[model samples]
Target: MPFENEFASYEPLRRILDNEKVQQLQDRLKVRAIEHDDETISEEITEKSQVEPSEYQPDMVLAIDGSYQAVKVENGFPGAEIGYVTVASVLILLEKIRELEREEFIDPKQFRETEKAATIDAVFPGCNVIVDDEDSAKSSMRRILFDELKNHIVFSEGETLLDTYEALLKIKLEQKSTPSRCPHDNCDAEFTYDYGEYQCPACGGKLYSSDAMRLHELMNPVGSNGEMYGQIMQTLEKLWLIHILRAFEKKGWLMTLRRVAFMMDGPLAVFSTSSWLTKAIIIELHRLNELAKKFTKQDLILLGIEKTGTFVNHFEDLDTTKEGVADKFPKQAALLLHDEYIKKNIIFSESLKPYGKDTYFGRKFFYKTSLGYKIVPSVAFFNEYQQNLTTARPNQFTRLADVMSLLDQVVSSRYKNAVTPLVSAHAEASIPLNLGRRIFEDIAREIREQS
Candidate 1:
């Protein structure tokens, strides 16, 4: 009996490790590392690169991010879930009226601060609760999603942005072929829905329910309020702003993206949960870029930055090798940039790796703005850089050398490998350290009389 119990303990882990689903994960992945280069930085990295910076400058730099806190819903609705969220977006004008550049000999705390630093901001704060019924929960979640979008959508008297947005949403969902499958993971049989009552043929279960009996099964559907759904709320919030920006582009109100850069907190790769939204955005952007010549306009500038990466750690060594004759330690860095660097030093893999075979939504590159501090720059510049700016032809290389050209305006002395505009935006957007807990207390007191 002791032996039987001991064997059973090990079996669970072994089964989990060697399970068919687990094995499928390993088969789908491959690793890529930076081909170690033995060259040190002998000269300034800016000198050797062959590319020119655009003469244009952004009129504004806008940055957006969201924060959320989960709370307990204890009022009569038993199986109900509750959460609160705050999304902040900040705008910094690239072109400003003349202002004092600096206070002559300022205190350390306020020295780098400028009167023009912070500009317009959009902050979203709200709570969400899901009760026992599947349909009721869906309605609640959908209301939160659309309410946020409608509140944020910019408009004028004549042009209707909201109407256009709804049309786009319909097209996005229909084109992507939203999956219809049994809500039960174990009985995930596919089906077609005509917006009518249904039951799972395979399990003889309620496919669409208004009660707790179907809670677990209901979690598998696309819009279900489960773990993945919670994770996706942030992405959905982001896409709402993107859709609005694209709508503006269509109306010719913002004739030029060159005068603006949109900064997001992360990469452009859209995950499976929101692939439909991603597809629609990409398709629309492509169409606009194709007609760019006719409109005499430029493409959108979206920048996603990460402060750390595999190549970042590798740059600590800076590829040093002893030379012939003089044998002096050179300042030349390996600079594992977009082209050859992605082949070797990519850090993530499997499901979390860079989006597969599709050329990245934005090309990934690396830069060392300061010694020993490295960063991964995810910029959309490469997609349009294929030609020599005269002939329409693919450049032999990624031609990301010019990206660092704007570093002078983008970099900040306050943070390593970070742009100043983003830092300011993040500071303004962030919820205070304990504000979520305080807000939760306030809600508990108001709603349930206890905290």
Candidate 2:
């Protein structure tokens, strides 16, 4: 539950929906609708409700991958691109979980009302303590049980149930191991008579000894490094994943009954490249997905997104004059389906695609067994910059000032309700604002000359 709460805090849907820009767009749409007839308005609403045209069916699964990097700061001052985190999530629906509760065979109500049932005080005399609330009582019970278990429990391989029973039996047997009062007037130590004389390790004071010391030791055992950090990371990752899954489910994805898969950006084993804490977190994610599948009867798809630009260069071979420029993007070529149903018949591969004039980018290739075409966006077109009207990184923009001026022209002269302000804000925080503005102006001048 705590994890669920934490995950909701990071979701961006609420922010995007509530944005002023989005509100303005809706307002404009409303005005436009008023100008149209009632029949036209109804048609518009119906069209908006229909699913967008796509080669694949709406039932197809989605796979997501996210990557994060810490932005380096100078003397605590944030630099451009600093504090900027990018996440890409792919979703693949493969299976779903059915809700079911394990049945309790016996009637607990009848057992509770029976006279033969044991009372708390009768079974454990003097063990009861006063508590301010029910929560405190439960906490006290847990502490007592934990302390008792740690003191006398010894486990063996494949003996989990037997070990628990033996532990309980040991606790019952040692219930009479209460400490004896010290005879020394100067000292306040308590000890058992069976253990002979007792002395405080810190002070030279002598006293009687008992089994209470063992209980104290058991209640405060030291934990290992792997257990502490591992548990924390595991909890965080599971909560985050669940939150995303729930969001998709709410968006009409059949997450509960259909098989779903996630594509992670890294290796399957987190410990391979990531920290031990990170590995623990990923393992927890795997466990949660497994549990989700079991409950929903859905299968999960997990794939790691990889890049091979280091070994091969495909940019040299791509012809820039291709008709479907948008269809040649590397990412489009590398698209993989996590669903088992899709994978069994699809021959998945990867190709190095050219971006701009020289850059090599990763592309996914999915060939279906059935006769149909899968259209994907081109790598070069996807990477192009609208402000510059050029295929270059923001930092590489030659006339940044010109680019901003061009953007201004587009916003003022063409689209009145454009979201350029938001885009400019993001660019300002990421790239050199002055340079970007110049590049925009130059781009605008180029377009004007061409026209």
Candidate 3:
């Protein structure tokens, strides 16, 4: 009876380790690791035999694209405008990798080959071959470049660049007599076709293919809601997953070699986005935590940075009820609640702090939270902009401060409204204020425990 009771006490941890779902996850991890090894060997042999010595160093880089299409502009600004921004973060073991010998860096390409091979092997294995004896290494590489690299490089058309790469690679593959075939179902067709159109003789199915379509498919596959809203949600979810993985890979490599610090440019959570998308992203992130433990054997710490002045001052000035305060607390509070919900659910790293307010040309006062950091807009930049026949500088500052100040107030007001008969009947369901507060407290507690 004592032994049984003790075993029952171990249930939670044991479920994490010994459950069937956990075993399946472990099996997938093992398979992935084996596949990664094979890919590593192939890449090492290929790079060592072909690539020049200079290219062998750890020059691998990751770039991400963040774009916002303004569907509706407030206060008589342009009705719609698409703002495109690209964020590129470099991950290099500058201190550690540089310490290797010149021979280690160049001669047999040991260092370069090892890292590249490991990345290739670990991220994706068995990607170079097809089931039917067709050598698809070039196409596989094209898919990777198109799906991962192009969109992140904002200046060029990702699809166009991928197309050019595929064409060049196809030429090389053709010279080696590798068979290129259509991937359509029930079609046993092979053609040394160029970059454009191919028609299947066996099934009459037209293949209008390009690297762009391939990338799109990766994000929004066929038979899985390709509507614009669906695509946007899918893209955001993919970005969230990729961001976590990339962060892990960055941190994992650093910790593997014993490094202390790392930095990120923006907040831990991606705010100014949709609520549904945010919730979906957080769900995927939770799943990623399980996946990361199985694959990398590391816990992810996503620390959000905030500025004390911004967080405290904004909350303080939410209402015009006080001197030096402005109105507009309602909408702002809603936005904060939305963001809080996201922060409560997603998991990330803890190595860096977030800045919440701008103090100088280059520096700012930063704050850290369980979710991530808060980044402030520069006064000078906002001052230069004109919106609704008024300088946006004052409005932006006032609105931001108001929103921060009124978060709790607005939430309280909303809670009262939810209880009101008219709204309660009209609205099928509403998130209670107490429940929201409890969620916030729970997240704070979890973060504190982890810290």
Candidate 4:
């Protein structure tokens, strides 16, 4: 009965209606309604922009991503958590889609016969972290997960699994100690663990990392949360790809690096505990590029393509914002979703947060493909974080300045916001239930054995 509960509360909703924050939002919404009313506002259509013929092209493109989820064992015990797993995958596009764009005419018959490519998928079987076995699972399963992920990793020449893992551990150590996750899975709270704090200030529970040297009882009992664990998996997946791609520099094969574009499945920026690793990656790429340019023909064509976000959700609904303006609103074509446009359209405005200014390792921008589908794309660059979020212009960029030629690398015809390679990669990387279930059975066994 202690672990069980019933929900029968509309009181919170009623209270929220009267809350100051809610009232302020209501006042703001009312003003927005008046300002953006169709009768009072002026609008115009935004014409499509043209993409120039390829100034540059990549012969191949690669994409990398991972799927992760955790499953709790309700039948096991009162307070027991269960299993977590991650499946990392990489997809390589060997065929060049840009070739079709360059060709004067596409003869369907010739196209079918002569040139076509599919994404080559390499799956990292899967890795499991035993969170709970319904009994006493004290085994260090996180290490096992990390180890297996490294073992199954695929990278280009000159990269090693051991080196990648050591790098990952270094990142884990570098994370800031304060403001960490709460000990309870349901409560995402952070407070001072300093000053001999024995329990989570938020839930009176505790949490921990899987450090063997420390006594488990001395540390917070609960381990990483779902979000943090997924991030850890993603961190490994990201580093694996970066290291592999970087090995090309050691190969000194400018021809391959030039013809190859790498598409990461998420935003160019790293988040959570993995941010340090991303920062290091940014620095390393700059260093490698500085040395490789003299030997290689062109800069690496790397991109991060995202299907959704705050910008994606709102902009997906609006092609152009022209309220109270002439026919001069910036078209949503490879432009930064500028602050002005954000104010004008007012699409999903309440959800927008004060931009946490991390100088992007990649330049973020929106692009409307030839097929008229809007997608966000980012190209890598060495940049620093901007801590102040109040500036009028938050460093929103239209497209990458230095990587102008790389824009040509995106192949747009059959697809909308996505390049052809990313689509294939996604297909390959998607974790089916059978292939990547949470390691519940393994977790249960481990806990039972330990008990």
Higher-lDDT candidate of 1 and 2: 1
Residue range with the least summed lDDT across 10 consecutive positions in model 3: 116-125
Model 1 misplaced stretches (Cα beyond 4 Å) = 1-34, 40-49, 76-81, 95-99, 102-128, 131-139, 156-179, 182-230, 290-298, 309-343, 348-355, 358-360, 370-373, 381-403, 432-451
Alpha-carbon lDDT of model 1 = 0.44
lDDT of 3: 0.28
Clashes of each: 13, 74, 18, 3
> Which of 1 and 4 is ahead in lDDT?
4
Question: Which has the higher TM-score value, candidate number 1 or candidate number 3?
Answer: 1
User: Model 4 — which ten-residue stretch has the worst lDDT?
Assistant: 117-126
Off by over 4 Å in 2: 1-83, 88-259, 269-273, 277-286, 295-298, 309-451
Highest TM-score against the true fold, candidate: 1
In model 3, how large is the Cα lDDT of residue 241?
Answer: 30
Better candidate by TM-score, 2 or 4: 4
**lDDT of the structure predicted as candidate 4:** 0.46
What residue pairs are clashing in model 4?
59-259, 207-220, 359-385
Per-candidate alpha-carbon RMSD to the true structure: 11.1, 28.0, 27.1, 11.5
Backbone clashes in model 4: 3
> For residues 254-355, what per-residue lDDT tens digits would candidate 3 score against the true structure?
222111111222233333222222333344444544554454343332222222343334333322343555442322112221122212222222323222
